[model samples]
Target chain A: MFDEHENGYFTEETSAEVVAARNAKAEDERLRDCVNILVKHIHAAIKEMEPSQEEWFKTIMFLTETGHTCDDWRQEFILLSDIMGVSMLVDAINNRKPSGASESTVLGPFHVAEAPELPMGSNICLDGKGEPMLVRGRILDTDGTPVADAKIDVWQANDEGFYDVQQKGIQPDFNLRGVFRTGPDGTYSFRAVKPKFYPIPDDGPVGKLLRSLGRHPYRPAHFHYILEADGFESLTTHIFDPDDPYINSDAVFGVKESLMAKFDLIEDRAAQQEAGFDEAFYLVEHDFVLAKG
Target chain B: MFDEHENGYFTEETSAEVVAARNAKAEDERLRDCVNILVKHIHAAIKEMEPSQEEWFKTIMFLTETGHTCDDWRQEFILLSDIMGVSMLVDAINNRKPSGASESTVLGPFHVAEAPELPMGSNICLDGKGEPMLVRGRILDTDGTPVADAKIDVWQANDEGFYDVQQKGIQPDFNLRGVFRTGPDGTYSFRAVKPKFYPIPDDGPVGKLLRSLGRHPYRPAHFHYILEADGFESLTTHIFDPDDPYINSDAVFGVKESLMAKFDLIEDRAAQQEAGFDEAFYLVEHDFVLAKG
Candidate 1:
């Protein structure tokens, strides 16, 4: 079967085709398709770039260093994918939701498996270093029906732009992280410090690539949420503050128009006191709509 | 400049454009072009594959594992590039020579810096295993003129398909490796054992990928050669024996019709005696042509 050519070796013109043809008898159909498309695009890129041997070696070294930088606390390859906007692209391709449904974004490498569960309106900020803020949101289906008994997992960086996990000893455990359950009304609220824009780890190969490309490593100031309910597709998304300077230039290309929230400052003492803040505070009200499974 | 869009965030339709736009101000023109093309093709692949989150994560894990497998002696990422035919493609792109010139293949990951220089007709096989073979080659320029004093650095695996470096203590040092200089006639000759086909390292991520793709890991029996001389472009290539079963399906895609050589078995006792062989032997007569610098 392989004797079609006297010396059927690789060539630039048929490189991708040859590689893809080798997968003709793949055991898994999905694997075959995945490898075929991957090889095709890789060869396309190579033809477009015509990278020299040195350039190719440089890429291999960059990948090796990126992998070496990853451990239990760091995932450099994910950061590479995120910085290249591949993560966001994949997410967008997979999550084609209804018009009114909330858009999804990249699930960054920072989510902890078990965050502390708190009651509604409980403060998540333990350091008290940032402006107090109140966030209220309702979980609803695309049909406008409330999603009862939904769970909202929220986490964010402090005003100093550092997550609790990033500054382990300095920040309180589970700082700016909490899980809240929605009532039968599908409403959930929580109080926490305003999130801050922060740079992704820039000391590794991905950072070097960002610098070389004249791009910043800062993601926009935002809060992360993982909302799940029965009979609805789980939504992993971010709520960006409109005031953030990086909103239009998120390093990871994770910003979405539907996910931006307007933060309103409450100067009136009555409103602040009603919100349980002793002074002026900010409030963000946004609704999340999930698609039915 | 980043404030052009109210929500100028990334979307599926504009992922690659958004990523490439970030490099608009790159100081290095080469880096800009490289990143631009890379980002464009990466997004193209993602769109074509539409990989699910699990599939995407699986790719990340595979890359990380490929990276982790690299150390001082091993480079699995290079192996990945090799088996996918990227290495040979890059070589072909970089080494475009005139008609009738010797074509180049992958240098592979096994060449050492220093090979023992031997006089012409010296035997490179120290272990005295397998069938004895003699290789006679002349180095010539593209214009057909002999390249005098040309250096031919040659290396190959034993009949068992293992290089001396792969089995250090078991095999004599530099058992199948030697550097020979051409005389005024631009001709060189050396004695060694016949080469054999071998599988690339298959215990790592690249091997797993090959298995999943239903591709074998075997490369045809070949002798590696790097020919160099004054005023000529150095050539790194291989001479594959046409009789090998895997000639048309080299695992690394390193085979080329122009590089194949026929191994003639010499059963005549007088010829064997003249060639310093006690029994029957094989002979390979191939000439290499180097392009002018």
Candidate 2:
């Protein structure tokens, strides 16, 4: 039988335990654990800060605004999580890879499911305006064997640093998005324009917070990819251009050395002919290895 | 100078530190400190939880829903804070009281400034619904000296446990809310119905969270008050009915032993006549002590 007189009441000293004790034993294990973890840490933070009433209310308002700013077309909370390095942390925790597999990173927010499916060696730069580049990569298993029929979905910002979705009418639908399935040789290739660094939406509450923190909102220019094969784990990752100025300071802390790829200048005529480009072009070649599920 | 090769990239081991370092040298000191506190604790929580990607995104969605639930008429976030014990924690931190001074608690979210200012001993219950109660008190300084002309704004739910605003059409406007000032003798009196224990709105994401945690949303029967006097600190607090079943376990953890008041049945005709009531009624008396600013 429970003690009738014993109750957890509000006090500065027992605040966390009181809050966390609300979780009943009948609750889902996952939720109980998560909420308890959150309660303990949030209370700890509040205790450490001892924020004034005004400051506490300001935080309440910030959370309100961050939540209010989310809608069907935009998710400001995820943006908040991303900028705070939470999305990356969660990604890292969930997608921990084996020693030789490609390291996974953030999937970002611009991916669209209906990106045009195309054949290998097709050009995704429909409105080509920047330096022509050939992106080639093979799908391999960790054991050095080719993984055939692997699907690679890729998307990137335009040369002007805008995604097709961000520009809407300005950029044609699916302008810089494509999907390809590798063949028996496990090789996949496509043509694209060099992506430009772009700023995240800085007009919302998250943006205001970023400004207040003296942090810039631009992410380093990179190509996004989601790779999948029949018996292997699907990978959500990005391929960072090493020469980009913002490589070291991604707004979301998503950059990793293993995910960095070299962009080489190809000048040989045979190389140009093989890639079906008339002149010298940039070649970004990086192979990806996947672990079986 | 910054090194070109070094970056605080996303890594599970260094996530919190990386996020905290993003607060640049030029940012506001207070904001930087608060954000760093938040970043560190949030990362610690995530690290402990190791929440799956779906679970993390569900949290993002929950936040968005909580935010979307707020509007000009309601503030779901504050309610969320209340049920989580955060609002009370923040209030306690900001209102640390001296010995012999009245303890402070949550202001709650239902207070309206439009409550009518009334004479002492006026009945706040426009509708004769529940047991009539005679409530009286004196406002005094920490030294027990009467503090004349002190303002005591009081409000509470009706016998049916509904605030005027919550039952707008059913209850008269300002039915149980009033503002009163003490006399030269520091005595203040009011007539009202004994408030019933009531549950907070259980229809939002916060409610879902509460239900999932096996917690009830009911707050004990209590009268809310805000006291202010010249040369003294303003106090936001509550006086709880000791007989109420939920008195010890408030949903928001707002209850403190010092804030409890005893209600006695007054059956003497002379006393009832003195209270201007034709029949026997309940009498609850509690004095407040405020600290000098």
TM-score, chain B, each candidate? 0.96, 0.95
| Top TM-score hit | 1
Q: Model 1, range B105-177, lDDT digits (tens) per residue? A: 9898778779899999999998989999999978989888888999899999998999999999999999999
Task: Specify the CAPRI tier of model 1.
Answer: medium
Residue pairs with colliding backbones in model 2 are none
Candidate 1: where are CA atoms >4 Å away? A1-7, B1-7
As for candidate 1, its clashing pairs are none
Q: How big is the positional error of residue A167 in model 2, measured in Å on the Cα after superposition?
A: 3.4
* Fnat of model 1, as a fraction: 0.76
Backbone atom clashes (below 3 Å) for every candidate: 0, 0
Give the TM-score between model 1's chain B and the true chain B.
0.96
Q: For model 1, what is the alpha-carbon lDDT of residue A204? A: 94
lDDT of 1 by residue, A1-293 (tens): 44323334577888888777767778999989988887888888888899989999999999999989988788899999998889888889888987788889878877887998899999999999999999997899988888889999999999899988899999999999999999989999999988888999999999988888778889889999999988888899999987888888898888888888999988999999999999989999999999988
Q: What's the iRMSD of model 2?
A: 2.6
lDDT, candidate 2, B82-193, per-residue tens: 8778889999999999999999988987789879899999999997899999999889999999999999999999999998989888999999999999989999999998
Top-DockQ structure, candidate number: 1
Q: Give lDDT for model 2.
A: 0.88
